[model samples]
Target: MALPSAPPRRRLRVAVVGAGVNGIAAAKAFRGAGHQVVCYEARAQLGGVWAPASHYPGLRLQAPRELYVFPDTGPLPPPEYDEEYPTAAKVYAYLKSYADKYGVTPCIQYNTRLVRAEPLYDRSDGGAATAASTAAAPGVAATVTVSALPTHAADGGKGLDGAAKGTAAAPAAGAAPAADAGVAAAVSSTGPAAAPVGWRLTLRTVPPELQQAEAGQCGGGGGGGGGGAAAAPAGPTLDKGGEGQDAGPREWAEEVDVLIIASGSFDDPKPPAYKGVQDFLAAGGEVLHTAHLRTALRRALAAAQTQKGQQQPRAGASGGAGDNGPCAIAAGASAPGPAVVTARFPAEPERGTEEGTEGGMEAGTDAGTEGGMEGAERDACRRFAQLLAGGRRVVVVGNGKSGDDVAAMLAASGAAASVTHLCRRNKWAVPRAFAGLVSLKWTLGTRAGVSLMRPLHPRPWPLGPLWEAARWPLLRLMEAGMRLQQGLAAAGAVPPHPLDVGLDASLHVEPPGYFAAVHGGRLQRRLGAVGALEAGAVVLGDGSRLEADLLILATGFRRSMPFLPPDLYGKIVRPDGTLDMYHAIYPHEIGGRSLFVLGWNPGLYGCLIADIAARWVLEMAEGRIRVSREQMRAYNERLYAWADAHFSPVAAADIRSGITVAYTWAHVDDMLHDMGASFARLTPWERLRLYCAPVAADLYTKVKATIPSERP
Candidate 1:
């Protein structure tokens, strides 16, 4: 891969918001390009969503260790780290180590929040100075104002052992130390046409007491004298938040050449809005989104431990010493491994709200239900399993991976006496092991297999039955493989799965032990939508009701950043709420240079995707990459066309619902094309082996090696 030589440009002062995998990758890449890098993480820790606080007890990576890392960061997990799906704790440790190895930890400002980011212009050429003015012309620069609060108010203003604290002359809120001036000057000196000045971020640090005070003041309780010691200044105070005679939040400004928004999606949990959800919560029934399962479970376990101590406390279980699974010693929680549990990986299901008529599979047009969940269904299942034993009658909603997981867990644990699963539609299921030996993903999780499965021409019309008929041979082979692994026909779960009506019944990795348990009558699979929640029962739309003590949502998270201003958010996001970007990384218009969004890309191998995007971002900032406006427009059109062709009816109903990047190969190829490279970068033999062989994590190293090294 050869990028055009970037013109001579001064180094940049890059600011990355969030210390997640993407943010860390961006910081490393930018710093490697001789730019000054600073990362802002709202949490006290470096790992964004993977921080121990964000994950449940048994959470682990879906991808194996080989695929979990970037080639440049570090080697694959050693024997010391839990191999084969490392636990969330191990993952966080790995990330922290990676940041430390690259010296990104020192650059990260923990407990710093980005309150607002307004784009700034250089105006040395002084055409238009307004923030809204177009940057299509040259000499534009960006400055961000930010607020940095104490790591913890109770800690007496200490920040990460004073590493994150700056001198009193710096901004009132935590700002970059005095050494940042040279970097800031270099950032403003970027090429006007290529790397424009990015954003002026306004950050505010909110200590716990201050947060409560602000909440009270904003809520009209009216105790306005909430004064807290302000953080050191990075630059001049652009604006102050407190009213007269009472100090509020202090703000500081920062100038950077590039602003990368690596804010992850998991922060916002989207609970489904069922009609009787409020009433159920009010009646003392719990509705814990899968995100908060760890906290909830910990509290429950603590209560249980306390109760046991009051009685005659038996010896507590050892931390599963010598266990192969990744366990967080601090959390006192065990990770799910192959011990006592059948190994099963979660399949990616479609996304949307299920909206189907009374009868199932009507007219071949309505394949099943509407509504698809987000990625990370696997962890949600493990969290749900932790709660299974507490409930007498468990009702699992959304018959996707989560529903299957709950059903299988209930049967395997022998926890719930009656486990009823409300499945409105029949979805395709593939056994984890296809022939009881080979992994199912190995068979179809490749580009070759996906290419074969995809239709040659777009089937826009509702010709699902015809498409099924055409692909009957392959479908039959799939059915046979599934049946061989999990005797579906012998167990009376005939036909194996629903009709492949316009991809309505796409095959997914079946949770282990689901069909067998259902066949044994331990778990009942009911096909109908929930009408409402009566006193202690879930009423079905078909006039039947099942008594359920615990109702698990299994619904997905809402992947939106509400913190972004409405006008800026509206421009970046489409009318349908889906991101409108080229290659899911860069916007088509020039104005997007000031801001970049990462980790929002929908695809497998997210870490790898972020690495590639980080490479592109470095290239863009250094003026090494260029794509014509017309070409960008065409590329976006192609993406929209493919999405329209592939998305399920339910997914199609909402613009934001469908998967942006469908599979691994095509998405990677599209990125390569944007980077002025081709699959040709791989050798002829390696190209042939791409679909079957493990992804070459070192591919980025090869690509970067091929490009001429810059001034750095």
Candidate 2:
């Protein structure tokens, strides 16, 4: 293994943007290793996305407390840790307390926004023949630009956002590479003399989006991202650092050494093409990004803003008012209770006549060995429940059945209602896990009850269990449903499908669509297109009048390098509109290792998959590895051959847009293997050193060496 370089001797100044969980985690890690860390949040608190409770009524964590909670600290109410999922409010309070305990709150600068991050280059050393740059110190000149194009070259780096039309064009042949720099003086100025305070980041305050005034609404996207989705129609800008101003309000910018972008993430956003998005996608639609919506809602409900914040329980909800205190279980597996978890499926109105539920069951049994797998589904559900039973709460995120199943398992496992079942799409069946049990609770109507609702999927099609990966979950749900109602046909009521696709007959088909995450959520892989989907419906492209009271796009977003420019996943298209992000990390041989992507790689289980990426990031901090400036270009030369031969997801046009869904007993293992491979193959050594004092590398070593593994 490559070794970490010696620690920096001088006191380091580090700025971690987004005071959310990740930000808090990073700061704790840094401080533990002796670095001075300053945390910043655009809003007034440390919880990035978690601060405000949008769908808070039912919110909870999906992974058990063991995995979700940070290292070295405990959540408030100290999770039952082996009982039931906690509520969203509990999670909120727990996170707040988490930050407070670490003293992270004092260092956090809330309401301080960072719009853009320009690395300062050094110029004082111009007298030297070669450009002398110092990684240890900061005071520099010109903004060192870090650009990440697509995985492939020649594909226009400019994404397909509709508004940015005119400037996107092919480069003239033989044009001098103006985008590059050659003068030694340009590189020399950044030498050691100047102590850089922090990055010069831009922070533009945007006005709130249109909402019912009471519900609350605003906009934002993935953390560390620097691209704009179809810019909402022209509007007033919120002015920041109001200096000499223009007619409209201007955004704000801050200068700092390291920028830990924690903008959170974009749920599968719709491509520029999906139909009906025009309503919410068009002029008057509220650009309510996931977090903004939550934040705005909180602001609207503030006791000062309104009356005691009249929060309403979801469509169907009921159960124990909520967890009064933490459970008394230990790290040992299994929730401590007589109530074991099981999937509670929606009864098929007519059983097998519908294709989805029944069809999926037929497909599942047909695809696998039934005898050995008979109890596998139950086992998986049990483990899932055990995971929640350990947490203060369970947050069932994602767009599909996995989410539903997550909810189902929690409730049946004698789960106390601290569960938030978030279905990414409005159109779809509830997972067996949450369908009957939780749905019944939701229907019962009670505070601290199951909140069954879809967030909205923006993929072109509304229903998407068609994805191959979904078959297993859908089938499992099918079997479970059948078991619940013996003699019932294989299919559930498929009249409208999860998204009410072909079932227009049922007025319940409200258009926005379903979360593919349901059912192993494997169907997304089937519908996910490599290119903008062949949208049968159009907006400005065609005079199609569209409407989606809620238009959710299942179109995935950039997971890694959000601060980098927009490139779908890591694929950067050139001006000509062709994609190429080498190895899906760097654009090509031309891009520097310092200017590429990571984390954007989608994984199956949870975020930070096994903390492998954490290991890589820490290495990059210590300068143990060096990524080539010629990123994917160098790696692509080899991977292209590999793709031509194997046609893995990179080459396979199908399955490109979906998150991995093979969630059998070995699903988590699959995630571990995949993440290990990516991390093992391309070390983070190539990334530009953003901060000297950051000792992520040391922390990883300590954790890996000392922390006992909590087997999932």
Candidate 3:
């Protein structure tokens, strides 16, 4: 008898929001699996964060580029671009190319915004089902609504309001308003009889043709569509006219089997609410969040470049006595001595801002008369060259990657008058490489390294003492190596080395210049908090003052899904401020499989993890990987319990950070086991040579091939 053929697999009509790395990858995954994928991006272009609008000029990858690309995708950078760590522009280009290679760009609708995705009840109209019988039955489907708006109105980076800004626009004749497009896909019994009820989507799109049509309707009043001749002449426009509501964009809706929230963090800019911040900005003291660096730094650098070009001597000025009498200023030399620092107190308490340290040396100290510039100092001076770029007095707040990166960039440029970093605590900074020789990937990114160094829970077994004893020799050796190679202690008085604190206080560092800069005094690392800002000055916690013209807040972002309804949001995001994801991807019990979130975790390899998540989601949709509600809840409880017991005090304050660090290995390892994939391909002898190697992205290729081409 002939072998039985597998049943036809179900294909979903998937809606993916955002054209970012995660979004693009998601679209590709769904489309490649024979599903219809529609990607909506609010911006006019792809490459969400990597796009020119979101990043600064000097931005580059913090980690190695080796694992940045998808494993199934071929060697990237195209050989034409040979840099290992490419600039922001190059990275953006790479993303664009990836979309093209995967054929995902075509399905993406640029300048489209997601308005809202509301669940549509099948049994009842609008309210929740209170009956136990009704609750046990298949739940209602959801509908997503989006409206089309002008690019200018949508790109303001405001919250959902910006997205829904033009939703009230009158529908034009013969045009398909976003509201009319709320068509759901037909369910087929052969493929997905058990598929979860779908979603209703509201979306908005701005087409050039529609803009011209609207302009013609208005008769030269522009695309505003207000009181002029452009007003719709007929009955039943997209919006049901109402008082107190402005004319919004045209909207439409669609029903999708899968709704992928690929709208990663970074859309909303969180501004610092320090006292005097508004006063300083109003007084012409420029203040910007790092999110605006791409625009802000680009303009500043272009102006400086132009001025430098104009000041350069013409080709004729390089010769003899006839060419020039005396050189006006030494080439490649800055003004003699350190920049001046002055203190100023506001005539009146400007919002009662606190005082801070004046950044220059003490009154009696002399320049170039301190300790010899060696080790940390040597590193600091090297970093100072980048910090002073553009001759701007900069004050960087927060000690995250963005803060450290910008500080180093300014110090190394040697164009800034002063660069001082205000930090809350002295967190451990792990160098990109251990001992300036071994890549951190080979040390911290490997299974052995993490397993050997992970903190043990005393509650479990007397394992805490055992872990401490086992790691003592390795910890001492590693500490000694770091001190000998980098001399981090001499750089500045950070807290006791993280190793001494059971690795609780450690912070990962990329590019490895921060420690050197801090210790060498090239970058002033102050042990205080920023109280407030005044004209030309910032007040520190210790009542000291620092003069800064440009204040850059490098505070990180918050994870939010404004599009999600309160009921759904409550289920996915917990009261503890942590996402209640089963594997940091799916909800424990979302009634049905209507929603899945990607790119929400803090992992060493974000791109890789997202790819893995895409695979897992697909498998779940195919009914191959089944996760019970009880099992997922138990897993999450254990994960959080461990975090509460072992993480540092600082980490405990934020549930996300604590769980992220503690479960990094378990997260990836468990996912691999679920997919039946190995982390590496090494000979028996080769595996013994190195302590351990980091998991390569390509290791999933074999497992991916095992996924049946037909269906589960």
Residue-pair clashes per candidate, as listed?
Answer: 32, 103, 58
Each candidate: RMSD: 12.5, 19.2, 14.8
For model 2, state the Cα shift of residue 377 in Å: 29
* Best-performing candidate as measured by lDDT: 3
lDDT of each: 0.48, 0.29, 0.48
- Assess candidate 3 and give its lDDT: 0.48
**Candidate 3 wrongly placed segments (more than 4 Å):** 1-8, 74-81, 124-196, 206-250, 301-392, 455-472, 493-506, 652-662, 675-691, 706-712
lDDT of 1 by residue, 106-213 (tens): 777644566555554433332222233233212222322222211211111222223222323233353322122222233223333222335555555543224333
How would you encode candidate 3's per-residue C-alpha lDDT over 250-366 as one tens digit per residue?
Answer: 555555556787766444434456777656655545555554333333333333445554543321112224312111112222211110100110011000000000110000000
Model 2 lDDT per residue over 258-334, tens place: 34443433422222333333232233222222222222222322322233345532111111133111111111212
Candidate 3 minimal-lDDT segment of 10 residues: 354-363
The candidate maximizing TM-score is: 1
Candidate 1: which stretches are off by over 4 Å?
1-7, 73-82, 122-196, 206-252, 301-389, 400-407, 428-430, 453-476, 483-508, 589-592, 650-661, 678-685, 708-712
Arranged by lDDT with the best first, the candidates are: 3, 1, 2
TM-score of each: 0.69, 0.44, 0.68
* RMSD to native, candidate 1: 12.5
